[model samples]
Target: MGYGELIIRSYDPQYDRTRVEDFERKCEVGPAKRVFLFTDTLGDPICRIRNSPIYKMLVAELGNQLVGVIQGSIKLVTVHKPPNDLAKVGYILGLRVSSLYRRRGIGSSLVIKLEEWFIANDVDYAYMATEKDNKASVKLFVDRLSYVKFQTPTILVNPVSHRMSRISSNVELAKLKVEEAEAIYRKFMSSTEFFPIDIGNILRNKLSLGTWAAYPRGESWSGVPSSWAMLSVWNSGELFKLRLGNAPLSCLMYTKSSRLIEKLVPCVKLPCIPDFFRPFGFYFIYGVYREGPLSGKLVRTLCRFVHNMASKSKDCKVIVTEVGGSDTSRLHIPHWKSLSCPEDLWCIKALKNEKKNSLHELTKTPPTRALFVDPREV
Candidate 1:
């Protein structure tokens, strides 16, 4: 069927659940892995985004065949620039078109339809992310449409080690009541990109374990933090896992060798896991912010604390988080010797007149600066 024949509609549980999931499964893949073998709620479209009012799921159908799917949400985002602007924007994600139906404008059509959804909701700015090397996606977002590659971000992952290190004695990390966390976020992180206006609700969500903040070991203050920083831990272990059955033949041949390479480059902390391995249990820390000259220490302490918490758990084995490379705050997160984890590219476009002055040329590689997009938003 032609692109014109494709029907784009909001996801319907009764009629579209299975087909929509199949399309998503067909699209989900690791950089090296051929397929994702296990089925779990992690990344499950229906379970994750289906119920939220802001979240919308759409699928493209042609003659009873599901060809593509996309999901997005409308949110009020904070811009770091002067005026520390607040914008009603659209965050688009999980855009996928079946391989057989691609190159015929199906993906583009899905995007256009979603753009309509954004405009109708009074959102003029839209943004999304993809791996740095996803050339086809780059072309689709930048060339076909007028999107700019704004930031490059790394996904930092630390495995739960058997023997965990202690968080610095200077840092008295305490779990904050949701109310306290919300207040701190407003004071310190409000200018952060994609900082949610309803931060309290986000912290209290089922998937969220809790939010913690760091204060000097001895301090008595209320309202806004003097040099406060906070981060929220997300329970992703319950979300999903990578199944062993999905391992490619190359994975089998390289597992032992890859392990050796990883050990040799331990300082780099490179991700060389065999595609066949299962990612059973993990925690991801997000909504991190800190102030002061030693704020980076607070960031590192938070990461270590979260990783240690996972290490203490019987089922958990990994800890992960993403930060915009342009974000100087990420320097506070641990990385060394220029060998870092995979850095993802974030691109954005303006549906109306909002971002014309702000958007830059994709070909222009500017110096990295501060960029912050809440991981939950993506």
Candidate 2:
């Protein structure tokens, strides 16, 4: 029990509707940050989360008042420890505590319970991401709890109104079958962190627009992807249509007039809205990766093509992707740097004894510069 006798228990839709809405209302991020990930098939806020069998949700209640919430999902991932070990890791997210409930130890209780679940599920590692500048979050996870500030990733967003860059003649942007997509992912993501063991499910999900692979025109599809990039596009219109969660004045104006207005106004910096707060008509691009010599150029081409395709839809106003801060791929993305939020921090800790002792070794390793944080998982 925490302050005011707080209680930690499973989330029940029937009783937690008002509480859930209140929690969602208090939070300031979206796509994943705005929308709760563990909702039911139809995305009914009150229904139980059935996104996957491995997912679970928890809520903290005090005096019959819901105050905090957290969710966890297990993924069998391959870590590059040496030859690559297939380890089950838990991705913890959707954490929110009402402003009235801070300093009550509700958050700590939730993480402890989730880490227990990870251990029971044979999860070796546990991790979650937050805005890097949130001092409260950083202190709670890193200083108060036994966690390490692992990786910082930039969340890239692009307004899709402009024309897209054309792919080079030698590069072919082809839409591939689920089988082809999975084959490429299995190879390119073998040494990646938090890689899904059941990538097939991801590729075939109902929301997935489709899986795409980019390669040289001369190459034939087969075992390994030589100079390549792959990504799955998710239609983000539903979430926005249901809950128009963006600021009213989101734009990409870079005219001389705009500069003059900014110069005249000392308080106003370049306007870049948050991803979840942006208005409707955007594609949340996920599971993106590039491999090869000209991978950067090729990947950029593929991304532009996707943006162009999405732009044709009246509902799609922007294209978004979250890439690790240290990932080489971020170099190629033409994102609104002034508008994007601060880097997202993914703080981590270990649950199993084998992983707990090896935490030091894991930290010493080259550090996972890039890993596919499936947008859907968020």
Candidate 3:
């Protein structure tokens, strides 16, 4: 059938089972595997939608068959804290189209529909990402729809063994209490790009742990300043790591959820956001202070702590982080070599009252004041 014959619609409760099965069969290759599996296993995509400040899901249908699906949500980019006068920017994620329906403008139509949804929801700008090698997707987003490439950050996955190798004799690591880690996290924020985090809220919502400095033997300090790591374990048995560092820097937290039974077999129970949501592994929530002589060392130390922890845990396999597209000073780190690239797919659309320049600049210009907010918030 021709592209015009296809119909697009939002996810419906009635179509759950059939659509999930269809998606599983269609998404056998490419980046669509996880998304397909998520939908199939969950049985209902709508249930996984995250209750964020703004949320949306759109799908394309060809007659009675499902042809394409697009899901997106709105988030406050607290990193920039743009003036309230400016329109709120939202992110578009979990967009997928079936392979059989290629070159038919189905994806583009879904994007346009999503843009309308954004406008109705009072969102000013929207953004999405695709792999650098996926020229077809790049063209669909960047060329046809005019979605600019915002931040392309590299994605890295470390086998458990790789994380273990980084634990050298020079450093000592220990788990810290949440309260102790929060105080140190506040200090770390003075130099990094991070949204203000609520320690209490984090402890309540998910499984979490903190790891901190043991104080190296040569340092003759009477009291050690608090420095640590923080990790949030999701329902899916995936661990998300974040770091907080002071002068004597260290990892802040490490958290992992235990698996649950599904159909008599153990299965990782991921956080219950909407099926359309994209799942990120780990986050680099804090950055090093540029002015300090030890800033570079601090960054390296934080990376090492993460590497060490991941090496020990077989379940924690991937580390996803975001760095400022504009920041050049602390760009190079030895451990970051395995990361894919520093660019991500950010889908965007212009609004009627919104200044084109604002949308244009966000997409074209490299962000200078970028901070890593927890993806859970997105």
Candidate 4:
């Protein structure tokens, strides 16, 4: 059958089992495993894409034969803050065309159809992510769909090797309590656009794994301070772990699948600026502080804490983080590099409404500045 003969439809409960199974088979990766890892079904990851509420599942059928499938969702651009117009953005999650139908434009057709749905639902911009190594997929997004390069994130891997790298010591790294951490975070980020790190969100979302502060050890601060936090998920033999910590100065974040420490050691062994960069692990740092001595120390200690945690997980391979528009300097850390550019879902309609047409390039935007989008409503 031809592409036009195929049909793309919204998700139906009757097709959930079939769709999930087909996705598992087409990818040679189980949906259950993928969903679980992304959602931390057994628990919660520091940051999760699977937890988004607005998933739209689409399937392509040729006279009843399931030839391909694509999943997309509407999300609020949460990273951006106020004074910037708030808008709903669309993200294409899982787009799979069967191997036999590879050359066909099934994926493209699916995206167009998805865009229609997005437009009808009042979405202004659509985005999707593909592995850096997937040239074909990248071409599909860029050349065919007119989707500009949104973000380029470097994917790093660390293979599991020695025990020392996997375990965390009770060594008192930084002595600041939760309150102190929050205070430092707030002060440093006073000029930026970030959610006030409330203790409630942290407790409710379980966001406190790697948080450390610079305040005197015993002093109690009122709430969770505003500091950079790193989130991670580990996939290893008989163990899966998710961790989050407040980043002080500098940290490394990358993605991997397995044998994380061993694979990362080679990169660490390279001549680098900081001796602490010599560790094997895969995870991404969402943000890191570059100014102030206290903040710098906090960032370094947090990086070390995350490294130690990864050393313990046997199944993890990849770690990913979304860096801010202003903080490209962190990407220069010897062990770290630019994975992708900061591509966000911007609304031309909103800009036009506000009588502003031109916007700065992603690289030119300050890292601390962000446009916040709440995914729940999207």
Supply the TM-score for candidate 3: 0.65
In the order shown, the candidates' Cα RMSDs to the true structure are 5.0, 5.9, 10.9, 9.8
Off by over 4 Å in 1: 1-4, 30-39, 42-44, 50-53, 80-84, 216-228, 239-276, 279-281, 328-342, 358-372
The residue-by-residue lDDT of candidate 3 on 6-66, one tens digit each, is 6666666575556754574445323431222232323445332453445667778776667
Clashing pairs in 1: 42-239, 326-369
Off by over 4 Å in 4: 1-4, 28-50, 78-84, 131-133, 156-162, 165-203, 206-290, 294-297, 314-319, 322-378
In order of appearance, the predictions have TM-scores of 0.80, 0.80, 0.65, 0.58
Order the candidates by lDDT, highest first — what do you get? 2, 1, 3, 4
Candidate 1 local distance difference test against the native: 0.68
- Reference-based TM-score, model 4: 0.58
> lDDT per prediction?
0.68, 0.69, 0.48, 0.44
The residue-by-residue lDDT of candidate 4 on 75-193, one tens digit each, is 54322443254456676766778777777788899988888888788775666655554567767877777666544433232232333332123222443445554555445443443
Local error of candidate 3 at 340, Å?
2.0
Cα distance off (Å), candidate 4, residue 314: 4.9
lDDT (Cα, tens digit) per residue for candidate 1, span 1-378: 344477889988788766666666556543333544443445465554432448788888887889888888887766544226667778778787888888988899989999999999988588888877778888998899777876677877665654566788887788889887777667666755556676666777887889887766676436434565668888766655545455567656666676676678766544444333654666777877667666677778888888777767876766767776766667666543222356687788877774565544322545334344454653
